[model samples]
Target: MKEFASIDIGTSYTRVLMGRMGDDGVIQINGAGVSPSQGVRNGGVVNIEQTVQSIQTAAREAELMSGLVVEEAVVNITGKHLKGENSRGVVAVTNRDRVVTESDVLRVIEGAQNIRIPADQEILHVLSREFVVDDQSGIRDPIGMTGVRLESEVHIVTAGKTALTNLRKAVNAAGIRVTNLVMSSLASSEAVLTSGEKDLGVAVVDIGSGVTDIIVYVDGGVFSSATLPWGGSHVTQDLSFGLKIPMEAAELVKRNSGCVQIAAVDPIEKIELPAMSGRPPRWVLRQEIAAIMEPRMREIFELVDQELMRSGKKNALSGGVVITGGGSRVEGAASLAEEVFSMAVRKGNPLPLGGFFDRVDGPEFATSVGLLIGAAQSTDTARKAPRESGSGWMQKLRSWVSENL
Candidate 1:
């Protein structure tokens, strides 16, 4: 049995999950922990010390519950600083007379990795959506195929080197080795999206406290990703500004009364608006609460739509959008998304792991669950070593210079 620890350092909270994958293939979740986030603001780490403290808190809690000390963990990365781009590469099969081998696949992926990146960033993941050999499309694996020209289209995810370095520092300070850094949207997709749904085409939107992450998948892999600066915190800010209430009171109102699409409440729908100490409480109509929230929610959907169109994938999604995270739990968000995208939408909660996971199976836990699942799946063949075409990083540097200079 292989035991691994997973941690999700999210905008609003950080969570840790410890699990054991038995030899029989059953994954047992032994323990987990969540702590209020401090290091991240809108998906970027602004305060390293606070972030380290949060990670330490969660790690200690997980160790306590699981009775196992965790020294390494698969961590999640996200925020507006992340960028995804599509690139295509074509490689001539060197040994035309011999059957294509795994080396050929690696060569193609290496060819795809030839792209320009900024000085302060590095490519984190290169995921192939499909492969074509001699104009034959939709081939998942091209090995043993008899084609001279192999082509591949891959999605490359990049993150700022400074951001990653800081994250690593914080994790190290918390006394954990960073096994791998999985992007937040990809992790969320794994936790909430199923294989069939991805094959059919689906967009998973993780709307957390500070930032919203969108991941689109079609034909069985990630198609694209987008990060928006708005999320649940925006709603809280709106309530605070519109209701003339304190931030904390506004937060309470949003959680208690806010609805994304319903602006007008029935005459009977009334909620008590808490006031600051020494101030009189106010009786507010539910409609007033919705009135403040609907526009912001609508704006978020509009921005998502605009981003989809910008990526030239506006009409490509077929399974529609699946919304997750604490923000997704807000009432009327699914309806709002449907109205904006004219497609089916559903709220996503973490999948039931059939063990200790039942306690943390909510949208907030999606990234954490994804981290664990990623740690488990990291052992698969998908993670192959790069062919020694001069180290992958060196090749990336050369490619960047070729394009930028």
Candidate 2:
């Protein structure tokens, strides 16, 4: 059995999960924790001390629950600083008789890594989208195939170096070694999307507290990824301004009475506004809240639509859109998205993982749970690497990179 842990640092909260994958292939969750985040803004670390405290608090709770210490973990990263682009690599088969081996595959992927990037950016993930062996295109795997020419198409995700350095500093201060850093949208996809959806072409939009994350998959591989600077907090700000309430009150109202579609709200439904500053409580029609919320939510969806069209994969989404994360929890969000995208839309809840699954089943916990999934996958890769090639760390990385292929 291999034990694994994951930490998801978000603008609103910090979450940790501990679990293990048994030798028999069963994945069991053992512990989990969540705490209000501090020193983080829009997924960037602003204060190392406060970020360390947040991570430690959450990690301690998880360790207590599982009766185990978390010394290392897979961590999630997000923000507008993340960039995803597609690149192609081509190489000739070197062996006699033209049989493409794992070495050829590795060489092609390394060639794909030659992309030019900004001085302050570093590659985070290189996911193979497809392989072509000679004349055969769209081949998922080309290893052991007979081909003189091998081509690889991959999606590369990069993050700002400064952001990553600060993030690692916070995690290290918390006494946890960061094993891997997975993008928030990619992790959320592992938690919410199914094989069918990814194979048929789909977009996973994770609307987080401070920023929205997007990743589109076509033919079971990443096609495009983007991060929008605005997110659910902007909606709360709009409600605060529109309803003449404090931010705390606006957040409360947005959670309880929020609906993004005016048509979905009941005409007579009303909710109580908590009394504040010695003012008596007041009643606001739920539809009135929706009225204040609709325009802002519509604007968010429109922006996402523009991004999809910008990716040029808007029409290729046969599986349409799946919205996850806390921002998508508002009532009528799906209806509003359906209207804007002119296609099917659905809420993405985290898929069940058995133990503690009930505790983290909501869209808000998708990234945390997905981090655990990534942890198991990485462990699996490491365990199989030596058997595959009798090599060390480089082979493990190659296996990790090839997982998407």
Cα lDDT tens digits for candidate 2, 1-405: 678999999998999999898556756788899998999899888899999999999999999999999999989999899999999999999999899877888889889989999999988989888999988998876777898999999999989999999999999989999888889999999999998999999999998889889999999889999998778888999989988899999999999889998988889999998678878888999999999999988998999999899889888899999999999998888899999999899999988786667778899988999989888877876767354542343335545564532
Error of model 1, residue 286, in angstroms: 0.9
Model 2 C-alpha lDDT versus the unseen true structure: 0.88
**What CA RMSD would you report for each candidate?**
4.8, 2.8
Query: Which candidate has the highest lDDT of all?
Result: 2
Candidate number of the best TM-score: 2
Model 2: pairs clashing at backbone N, Cα or C within 3 Å? none
Candidate 1 lDDT, 289-389, residue by residue in tens: 89889999899988988877776765777778899988998888899899998889988987777459786789988888988977765533123354333
Q: Which stretches of candidate 1 lie over 4 Å from their true place?
A: 379-405
Error of 1 at 81 (Å): 1.4
Instruction: Please report, in order, the local distance difference test score of every candidate based on alpha carbons.
Output: 0.82, 0.88
